[model samples]
Each structure stands twice: as structure tokens, then as C-alpha cells.
Target: MFLPAVVLGALVLACLVSLGTGAADLGLADLFSGSDDSSRILLVSRVPRTLAAVLAGSGVAVAGSVMQMSMHNRFVSPTTAGTSQFALVGLLAVALLAPATSVMGKMLVASACAVAGSGLLLRLLHLLPARRTPADVTVPLIGLMLGGVVEAGTTFVAWRYDLLQSLGSWTAGDLSRVLAGRYELLWVVAALALALYLAADHLTVAGLGEDAATGLGLSYRLVVDLAVAAAVMTAVSVVVVGTLPFLGLVVPNAASRICGDNLRRALPVVAAGGALLTVVCDVVGRLVHYPYEISVTVIMGVVGAGAFIVIILRGVDRA
Candidate 1:
């Protein structure tokens, strides 16, 4: 009870701070003052940015949680599994081939590619000889290599097409550019979250193992596919905002530590924690340099990297 209240309060505070901290100063007075600049900034920039951060953070965190549960590996996530890189490849192709495509069309293409990439990773994991090596060690390594390969291909394509600069923005998760029309796709994360909640029990059961899920009369493959689809869509849709590194890993792991492995009970907490952490990071990015903002991607990279190291160390200790 107390934990939920604290997280909710922090989330609210983060939203408020995100709304006020930007190039243009805004306050409660400014919000209601009818000043054109303040109103425009609020409507066009701050609100959208806040929403994007919250939604992206929540979506990515939930996706990470689902990935860990279904894959039975904590390190595997959209970032580690090459989902973002694959999405970038699709985004680059669309940009080059169909430059006039709508944002939704681009996202659809990206989501498809992301799903493919994640599916390939899953296949690789399945093919790995569990008798030869532990999965916890193998899965993340495979994912990293896969992501590197996809990233290299994306870089090559972007370089060839002179779209490296554009690709750079997508690779770096930055909420600074979020605007009303541009950031609306992130709201799809909300629906995705709702769907995850609805299927939380099935997902949890699926995580127990195929035989166990089958014993429970649940289609293990179907539940995994649904979970993967939700995660891929959540990850790919947030490409407009930029890639959030380690967010899925760190947040879900943290949530699991605090709340345990019961997906039905833990999913909402993980989402809220993700949203809070992201908003706080965004706020820190704004205030760290003061006036000139550091991108949230940069901040999260440093922070997430540190957190990941800690998680690994803890895992080793447990082993």
C-alpha cells in the first residue's frame, strides 16, 4: 500500500516537473494566463514530452517484464534482443523507399521488423544447447551479438543513404523533440499495457515452462506470441521518442525484486516504477546542464549501464 502510494506520488511529481522544466519556463499561472507563447509551448511541447516519457517508460518496462517472464531470462529485452535495431532497419528502409509514408505506416513497418527480430532471437535461444551452457549467460550474449549485427547493417544503410543524422536521432531516445502530432503514437503503449494486464495470468503461467502451461490447458506458444507481440509493438512505437537502453532490464528487475515474480500483481508496479524513473531521468537531464538539456537517452545510458552492472554482480553472487 505504502509502496504504491509513494510510486504514484513520485510519478505525479515527475510529470509536474517535466511540464515546467524546458526552454520556456511555465508555471500554474502561465498555464492559465492565456499567454500565447506559454500556451503554445504547453500544448505543443511540454505536455507531449511528459506523456511520451511516461508512456514510453511504462511501455518499455512492461515489455521488459513480459520478456523476462516469457523467456525465463532476466537480461533479454527489446534492447538486448535487437528489437530496436531491427525496428531502426525497417524505419530506415521506409524512410528511403517511402519517404512520404505516414507515421503510423512507418510504425507498422517497424513493428513488423521488430517482431521478426525478436522472433529470431527467440529461435536462437531455443536452438542453444541448454546442456552445454546456462541460458542466463547465453541469452544476453546472443542478443548483444544479434543487436550489433543489425545495428551495423542499419549504420551501413544510413551511411549509404546519407540518413545517418536522422538515424542518430532515432537511436538516441530523446523526448526533447516530442510534439503533439509526433508523440501521439506512444499512447498505443497505454492500450498495450491494458492488454498485458488482461493477459497477465496467462503470461505468468507461460513463464513457468511449456509443459507446465500445457498442463494448465494454456497454449504456451499462443501466450508467448501474444506477449512478444505486445512487447514488440510497445518498443517499436516508441522509436519516435528514441531508444531507451536498459530501461526494460533495469525497471523490471527492480520491480521483481520489490514485488516478486507474480506478473499479475507486479505488472502495474513495474509500469509505475518505469514511468517514475523515466520522468525523473528526463528531469535530471533538463536540470543537469541547466538551460541546455542533455538527452534522456544519454542520461539513461549512463544510469542504466551502472544499474545493469549491479544486477549482474548480484546475479553472480546468487549463482
Candidate 2:
């Protein structure tokens, strides 16, 4: 109860700060005062940024939880598993091949690529016998290597087409550009979260070995596919906002540590934690430089990487 209260409080504080700390000076009072400039800025920029952060953060964290459960590995995430890179590649391809494509079309292509990349990663993992190499060690290494390869391809293409700067912006994970029309895609994340919550029981059951899940009347393959799709879609959808490094890894792992692995009970908590953390990071980014903002991606990279190192050390200690 106390923990939830604290998280909620932090989220509220972060939202408030995010709302008030932009180029335009606005506050809760101004929102109701009906001043056009304040209201316009509030509605147009601040609100969208706050909402995008929460939705993207929660969705990615939930996706990470699903990935860990379905893959039965803690280290696998969009960032680790090359899913984001695949999405990037898709987005780049769309830009090069059909520069006039709508944002939705680009997102669809990117999501399809993400799903395919996840399937390939899973296939590779399956090919490596667990008896020969421990999954905990091999899974993330394979994912990182795959991600590196995909990232290299994206970089090469972007450079060849003189779109390196554009690709850099897309991958930077900054909420500063989140305005009304630009941030609408993040709402899909809300729908995905709802789907994940409804399917929580099946996902939990599927986390048990495939044979065990089949014995329990679960369609293991179908559940796995659904989980992978949800995870990849949630991840790729947030690409418009920027890549959040280690967010899925740290948030879900923390939730499991506190609330256990029961997806039904843990999903909401993980979502809330992820949202709160992202807002806090965004707020910090806003204030850390005063008038000039640091990208949320940079802050999360440092903080999330630290949290990840701690998680890894703890795992080593337990082993």
C-alpha cells in the first residue's frame, strides 16, 4: 500500500513538474484561468509529453515483462533483442522507398519487422541446446549481437542516403518533440497494455516449459506468438518517442522482485513503476540543464544501466 502510494505520488509530482517546466510559463492555475497562450502551450506540448512518457514507459515495461516470461530469460528486451533495431530498419526503409508514407504506415512496417526479428531471435535460441550452453548467458549475448548487426545495417543505410541525422533524432528517445498530432500513436500502447492484462494468466502459464504449458491445456505456440507480438508492437510503437534503454529490463525485474512473478498481480505495478520512473527521468532531464533540456534517453541510459548492473550482480551472488 505504501509503495503504491509512493509511486503514485512520484508520478503526480513528475507530471506537475513536466507540465510547468517548459518554455512557456504555466501552472495548474493558468490552466483554469483560460489564458490562451498558457492554455495552448499546456494542451499542445506539456500534456502530450507527459502522456507520451507515461504510455510509452508503461507499455515498454509491460512488454519486457512478457518477454521475460515467454522466453524464460530475464535479460531479453526490445533493446537487447534487436527488436528496436529491426524497427529502425523498417522505418528507414520506408523513408527511403516511400518518403510520402503516412506515419501509421511506417509504424506498421516497423512493427512487422520487429515481430520478424523477435521470431528469428527465438529460433536461434531454440537451435542452441540449453544442455550445451546456459540460456541465461547465451540469450542476451545473441540478442546483443543481433542488435549490433541490425544497428550497423541501419547506420549504413542512413549514411548512404544522407539520413543519418534523421535516424539519430528518431532513435534518441526525447519527449521534447511530443506534440498533439505527433504523439497520438502512443495510445496504441494503452490498448496493448489492456490486452496483456487480459492475457496475463495465459502468459504466466506459458512461462512454464512448453510441455508443461501444453499439459495444462494452453496453446503454447499461440500464447508465445501473441506475447511476442504484443511485446514487439509495444516496443516499436514507442520508437516515435525515442528508444528507452534498459527500461523494460529494470522496471519488470524490480516489479518481480517486489511483487513476485504472478503476471496478474504484477502487471499493473510494473506499468506504474515504469511510468513513474520515466516521468522522473524526464523531469530530471528538464531541470538538469535549466533552460536547455537533456534528452530523457541519456538520463535513462545512465540510470537504467546502473540498475541493470545491480540486477546482474545480484543474480551472480544468488548463483
Candidate 3:
């Protein structure tokens, strides 16, 4: 709770910094007066960008936390293991299936496809012989292979249709295009949050392994289905935002270190940490290049990859 409060405060401070400090700087007084063009820029451009960063960060982080807990794996996430890739496959299928559909329609198709793909992947896991090793290690490796296959398929389709550039756009996340009507789809984040919150207890119990959860009279399959649904919603959120890798893996782990592994208690803190980290990254990206903005994907990749390496090393040492 204390950590989350601090993250929330940091997020607030970052938002203010993003608003006031841009390529075209606007002073605090100038921002409040609302007369200057700078104020309008601040309101119209930076504010929306900041909000998008917050939404993307919070959504991905919380979703990742839930997913990691549900899977009982500290190393897995939508980004790390290719759930987002499959989600992109879903989005691409929608576009290919109906070339002229509305964005909402497209998102629906994508979400459904993502859910189906994820469900298939989960079921496929049942076929593999029980590993002597931890489920976490094997699950993500399988998911990575699955994601690679999906990506190859995506690439082939894009090449055939001459939509490679269009496909690439959704694969890499960018906030520059965020504005009034376009970003409302991000409200899926709110929906994901609500669903996960309601199911947190069930999810936690399910995380205790299937036999254990069944002993408690919980339907293991149903609980897992719900977790996958939550993950699918998360996949769609990241697909919409573009892929910001490591937000999920890092945020929940960091929160767990401070708050313990209780998903119900750790969720809000993880979400706040996710949002704060993203905003800080986005602001840093904008400032790093001055006139030209750096893609959040690039920035996160450099930072997230490093953090993940450290996590892996630490985990190995502890083992």
C-alpha cells in the first residue's frame, strides 16, 4: 500500500512534468491561463499522450501480474512469451477477414481470435507429458515457439497482401497517434481490471495448483478459463497500445517483493508501478531526442531486457 501510494505520487509528478516540459515548453502559469497556443498544445497533445501511457502501463502491469500468478510462473508474461504475438495474429485475421470493418468490429474479432488462440495453446499443454521440471519454465518456452509460428504466419499474410507496413504499425506500440475517439478502446483496461478484481480470490486459489484448488471445491478448469480470458483481454489491450514488453514481468515481480504474492493485495500496487514506469519511460523518450520522439517500444526494450536479465540471474542464484 505504501509502495503503491508512492508510485501513484510519482505518476502524478511525471504527468505534471510531461505537461510542462516538452519540445515546446509551457510554463505553469501559461498552462493555467489557457489562452496561449502552448497551453492548447499541452492540453491537446501531451495530456492525451500522458493518459495513453498511464492506461497502457496500468493495464499491462495488472494483467501481467494476474497472469503470472495464475500460471504460477514469475518469468512469464504476455510480452515475454508471445501472447501479444498471437493477439496480433488475431488482429491481422480480423483485418484480412473484413477489410473495411470499423475499428470496434476489428477489435472484437481480434479479441475473440486472441482468446481462441490462447485457449488452444492452453489445451495443447495438456497433451505434453508432465514435466519433471517446473511448469513455468516449460510453458513459456512452448508459448515462445507458438508465438514464433504465429509470427511467421502473420509475416506470410502481410507479405501476400502487401500490408506489411500496416501490420508492423500494430506490432510496435506508439502513443503519438492517440487522440479523442481512437483511444477509447483502451477502456478495455477498466473492464479487465474489474473482472480480475472480482475473480482474484478464485485465481489465487487456482494458482495453488489444480489438485489443491480442486480439493477446495474450486473448478480448476473454469478458474483457468477465466484467467486465460483475463490474459486475452490483456493481449488485446497491449495489441491496441502496441507492445510494451516487460511491463507485466517487472511490475508484478517488483510489487510482489514488497507486498508479497497475494494478487488481491498486490494488484493495485503493481498497476500503479506499471503506470508510473511507463510514464517515466515515455517522458524520458520525448526528452531524449528533443524534436523527434523515440518509440516507447525501443526505450522499453533496452530497459526491460536488462531488468529481465537481472531477474533471471537472481532467480538462478536463489535456486
TM-score, each model?
0.94, 0.95, 0.92
What C-alpha lDDT do the candidate models reach, one value each? 0.83, 0.83, 0.76
Candidate 2 all-Cα RMSD: 2.0
**Model 1, global lDDT:** 0.83
CA displacement after TM-score superposition, residue 303 of candidate 1 (Å):
1.0
lDDT of 1 at 166: 92
The pairs that clash in candidate 2 are 173-242
Error of 3 at 233 (Å): 2.9
Cα lDDT tens digits, model 2, 1-319, are 6776777788888888778886566766676687888878988898899999998998888888898888788887788888888888888888899989988888888888888888899889889775422137578889999999999989998999999998998789899988888888888888888898999999989887688999999999998887765545554555669788899889988888887778998888888998998988998898898778999999999999999989887772211
Off by over 4 Å in 1: 32-36, 130-135, 316-319
lDDT digits (tens) for residues 145-213 of candidate 1: 999999998898899989999999888888888889888888788888889889999998987888889
lDDT tens digits, residue span 1-319, model 3: 5676788898899888877766775766666776769767875787777788888888888878777776667877776557788778877877787878877777777777667766766776778765423324677787778888888989999999988998888877787777655667777776777788788888888887888899999999888777665565666565567888888888877787778767788888887888888888887788898877888888888888898887776662111
Looking at model 3, residue 100 earns an lDDT score of 81
